[model samples]
Structures are given as C-alpha cells and as structure tokens.
Target: ATASLASQGTANIWSCASCHGDKGEGTQTVPRLAGLAPAYLAKQLHDFSKGTRISDSMAYVAKSLSETQITELANYYGAMSSPSGAQPALKGDLARGEKLALSGDYSKNVPACFTCHGTSGIGVGAQFPGLAAQQPAYIAHQLAMWAGGARHNSPLGLMAGIGKALSDEDRRAVADYLASL
Candidate 1:
C-alpha cells in the first residue's frame, strides 16, 4: 500500500529523493533513508507531521503530504537495503552504560533504558527509536538535543528529563555501547 503511493513520484513540496537523494544516501544535512527500518521511518514521519520533530525544512516538506502519504514515504525509505551509517566504536567504558541500560542507578532511582528503549535498544511502543546500530556521534547529538529540550519529537517530553539525569560520562558510555551493538 505504501509502496504504490511513494514510488509513484514526487509531490509539490519536494520529491522524497530530493534531499534523501535518488537512493536515500542523504546529503550532509539530511540523514540516510534507505535501509532504515520501516518502524523507525514511520515514527520520524509521524513526528514531523505532528509538529513534534519541528524542523522547518522537514515540516515544510511534510505539509503537502496526506497522512497516507506520510506513511507511504516512511515505508518507502524504511524498506531500503544497504543502510548508510558509520562503523560502531567501543572506546568508552561501558560499566556505567550497562548500569543505565539494564538497571539504571537504583540508588538514584533512575529508570532503566529498557523502560522506553526495550531490552535490546530496539525501541518499544509508540515512536521510540531502535538504538542498536546507530552511530555514536548521532546518538550523542540526539541525547544532547533531548536533554536541552531541543528535540520535540519525544511525545511524552521525557527525553529532556531523562537526558538531564545522565552524566557526561554516562552518555559517552551509552554511545560507545550502542555503537558496539
């Protein structure tokens, strides 16, 4: 259903490939689309449409699309193979990351990463993202954005709160571990 509409062609605002590139390799600013999971792609589209992600470029591009079109676009990009991403690195210590991801700081009463991210960093209900294979740079950027209230895509507004709870060392640890995964 999504494929039929997406590949049919571009719309008035912008063709899906305009920024993502013909094959979804993404530009310097735009992120790669091809090879991304359909689930992740759908969440991003929904976030942009709902004003949660709040990117002027993305919102502008998204405005012309219908809800069905959004789903189709997301599905189109998500279904791609040969996803573009950097190789994971594991230099930072992971003990703290393990604590945050698995049990959190029980003494600090911090919540487990699995509460929102699921057991394997694969995300869960709603629009949470899968963290398994993302690049460390992107992960740190996203986390910082959440902590600073810069990213509005988080529906529950929990990212800022959660991000604030983490120390810099913890963030690095998690990013490193995520790359390793």
Candidate 2:
C-alpha cells in the first residue's frame, strides 16, 4: 500500500518518485530517502507538517499524510538500500572538507562532523541521519537553513549553532567531501 502511494500519488499529492528517484536516490537538493533511519524520516515529516522545517513542497506533502501514512512511508524508504554515488558540483576543497570532517577547527567553535555523525558520516543514530552519498546541494542547503534559523528541529539546537559557526566555504567543503564518500 505504501509502495503504491510512493509510486502513484493521490489526486491531491505528487508522486514521491517525481523528485526523489524511483529507488529513492533523490536528485540534487531533493534528498535521498533510501536506507535512512525510520525514526529520523518520521521526525522530518512531522517537522515539515508542523512548519518547523521550511520546505514548501515537503510541508504540503507532509501535511497531507496521516500519521499511519507517515510511518509507512518512513519504514518503506528506510528498508530500501541503494549505492551511494553523488557527484560533487560544488567545487569545494576536498582536503579542507576531510580535515573538517575528522578534526574541526576549534577556533571556529565547530565540532567535528564525525563527532555526532559517526566516523564516516554514516550517522550515529535516529538523531543524525547518514550523510554518506547525500546530495551536496542538499547538505549545503540544510546548513544554510540551520544557520539562518529556518530549520531548528535539531537536538539542543546543536546543528543551528554549528551551522552558524561554519563559513560558507566550510559548509561547501564538508558537503562535497561527505557526498564523495
């Protein structure tokens, strides 16, 4: 039933595959849904529905989903496994990104990405979604949102503080590096 909904949207909604690939790979800035933590996905949907996260399309779709539908969709996407192959178009400094991912610059008050995101940005738990193979554009966009306080659902507002601390170049570098992994 959820698969049907994912593939064929109701009269009022758009199909998930329209923007997210048929395999949930997702296009630039759309976000890959496959293999994500179900709880994380569900939280995002709830955030969108509540307007805590800012995305016009996501808000519309999430608001239309019933609680059961949200759970089903989250589980369906979480069960899917896909290869990571996001190409970087951001032209960020890979070396800097690697350094930031592994060792943050204390001068900037930024914690290492891996501190919460896991060693390789594979995610730590339900709170931190995997960054591996995510679209660089999406990652950059989210960082910007967090920095601007447009999205603030993160735990203890940690992401927002980190986002504000990172320079534009740092954000791009880390985003590109993570996508390449």
Candidate 3:
C-alpha cells in the first residue's frame, strides 16, 4: 500500500504522493488527506468517482480505483499523523475572519463555522472536514466552487448556502485565518 501511494503505476494512475506529498501534507492547491476521518475520505473518493464532487483530476484518479483500494487508502491516510508546515495563501482581515468563524453573521443566516466544524476547525467526525492548517488557495477555491454550484457534495447544501452568502473578501479572510490555524 505504501508503495502504491508513493509511486505511480504503469497504468496511467498518478501516485497519491505525487500531489498530496509522502505524508499527505498537500500543496497550495491540493489538500492534506492525513488524519482525515476514514469514512470521510472514502466518501470523498466515492463522490469524486460518481461526479457528486467535481474535480477533473480526482474524478479520473478515483474512477480508476476499486472500492477496496479506496477504503484501504482512506484507512491508511486516516491513521497517519498530520504533518506541519502549512502556509497562508491569501491576504485578508484576520479580525473579521475570526468573527465570522466564531460568531458568524446571524442576520444573514450564516452559522458559525465552528458550530459544525468544531471549536478549532479540526473537523467533526466524518461530517465536517478539518480546516486548520489547510492551504488557503484550496479553501478559497472550494468555497468558490460551492458558491458557484460547481460542487454540491456537502450534506443538505450546507456549504453551498454558506459559500453563496460569503463575499469574495470574506472568503479570502476566512481562508487566510484557517490556514493560520
């Protein structure tokens, strides 16, 4: 499993490490997979393969894997320790971002991200994902995708509505703040 995850095969499949890094630390556009819930990871792989999530690269790679492989990969990454060294990818108002993340704008029906994502944004089981130390570019891109209806994998359109309610500046702020965590 380590070999497969670290090296690409001859069958046109890109190794997970090629993009996500050996320890699943991820890059500017990619997201860290290490320490994610096994269930969440498996669901994402399934979603990518089924088009419930939209990502050309992920979809293609996920489509090539069997269910067993997906589960194995998920388990492997889920049990691994999260790596450090994430950096911010955007500039924004940190104070405003903190307010949004902790209290939100109730007038706009925006719930605090921490309400569902946990106090530190380390995620809530398989339901919400960890936002701490993630790539700001990845976070901002996902928000944009949800806002534009290009991504709809979040349960009950939760993220879609939240994304739509956030202004471009808000998105950047939140992304930057989360990366700081």
Candidate 4:
C-alpha cells in the first residue's frame, strides 16, 4: 500500500504521493486524503473511474487501477492520521466567509455549507467531505468546477447549485475561511 501510495512503479503512471504528498498530507490544489472516510475515498475513486467526477489526471489514474486496488488505497489513506494547523493561502473576508458557512444568504436561497459538511466542516460520515484545513485553491477550483458543470459527483446537485449561486468573491472568501479552520 505504501509503495502504491508513494510511487506508480512505472513511468507511464503517476503516484498518489506525487500529488497528495508522501503522508497524504496534500499540497496546494490537492486534497488531504489522510483520515478521510474509507467509503468516501473509495466512492471518489469509483466516481473518477466512471466519469461522474471529472478530472483528467484522476480519471486516467483511476482507470489504470482495478477496483480492489482502489479499495486498498482508500483504506490505506483512511487509516492514516491527519496533520493539523493547515494555513490559508488566499486573502478574503473571513467574517463574511464565516457568515456564509454558518448562515447562508436568505436572499440567495443558499443553505449553509455546514448544513451538510458538519458543524466544524470536518465532514459527515462518508457522504460529505471535511472542508476544514483543505487547500484554498483546491476548494475554490472545485467550486468553479461544480459551477461550470465540469464536476458533478455531489449528491443531488448540492455543490453545483451552491457553487453557481456564490459569486467569485464569496467563493474565495469561503475557501480562505475554511482553510483557516
């Protein structure tokens, strides 16, 4: 599992660690896989394979692996411990972002991000992902993807709707705030 996580073993393939970090800690624009729900990780792998989620790199990587391999990788990352004190990369209105996270704009009819992402945005079971400490670029990019219809793996179009509803500044603010958490 460590070998697979750290290296792809062939020049044609890309290692998970190359993007997600050796300890699954993640870097800018890459999400931390450590301590994520096994089921969530597996589901994302499956979704990547099936095109429900769209990422050119991930699709290629996921398609190269068998289902068993995906499950193994997911479980490996899931069992690992997550590091703390991640820093924010973007500059935005933290107060406004907090309000958006805790209380959605009623005029826009958008629901609070915490409604599904958990009170602290650390995730909710295997359904939602932990937003706290994630990379701002990744979060912002994902929101853009959802808004643009390039990614559609969220349950019932939840992210898509929210992403579409939020202005670019709001998205950045939320991303920055979430990263600060």
For model 2, how does the per-residue alpha-carbon lDDT over 1-181 read when each residue is reduced to its tens digit?
A: 7998899988887889888988999888999999999999999999998878989999999999999999999999999995586877699899999988999889999888999998799987799889988999999999999999889899889899889998999999999999999
Q: Candidate 1: deviation at residue 42, Å?
A: 3.3
- What is the lDDT for 57 in model 4? 87
lDDT string, candidate 1, 31-106, tens digits: 6567566767777766776776757877776667777777777667766763445343535577777667778776
Q: List candidate 1 segments past 4 Å from native.
A: 1-40, 81-85, 89-91
Model 3 is weakest, by summed lDDT over 10 consecutive residues, at 1-10
Which prediction has the highest TM-score against the true structure? 2
As for candidate 3, its clashing pairs are none
The superposed Cα distance between candidate 4 and the true structure at residue 151, in angstroms, equals: 0.4
Better of 1 and 4 by TM-score: 4
* lDDT of every predicted structure (CA atoms): 0.66, 0.91, 0.86, 0.85
The RMSD of every model to the true structure, in order and in angstroms, is 4.1, 0.8, 1.3, 1.6
User: Which pairs clash in the backbone of model 2?
Assistant: none
Error of 3 at 109 (Å): 1.9
Q: TM-score each candidate.
A: 0.69, 0.98, 0.95, 0.93
Candidate 4 lDDT at 138 equals: 85
- Which model, 2 or 3, shows the larger TM-score? 2
The reply for model 3, stretches above 4 Å from the true place, is none
lDDT by residue (tens digit), candidate 4, 1-181? 5465455534556888888887788877888888889999999988988998899889998888777878888888888888754676777788988999999887887899999999989899999988888878888889999999988989888899999999889888998899898
Clashing pairs in 4: none
Candidate 4 stretches greater than 4 Å from native: 2-12
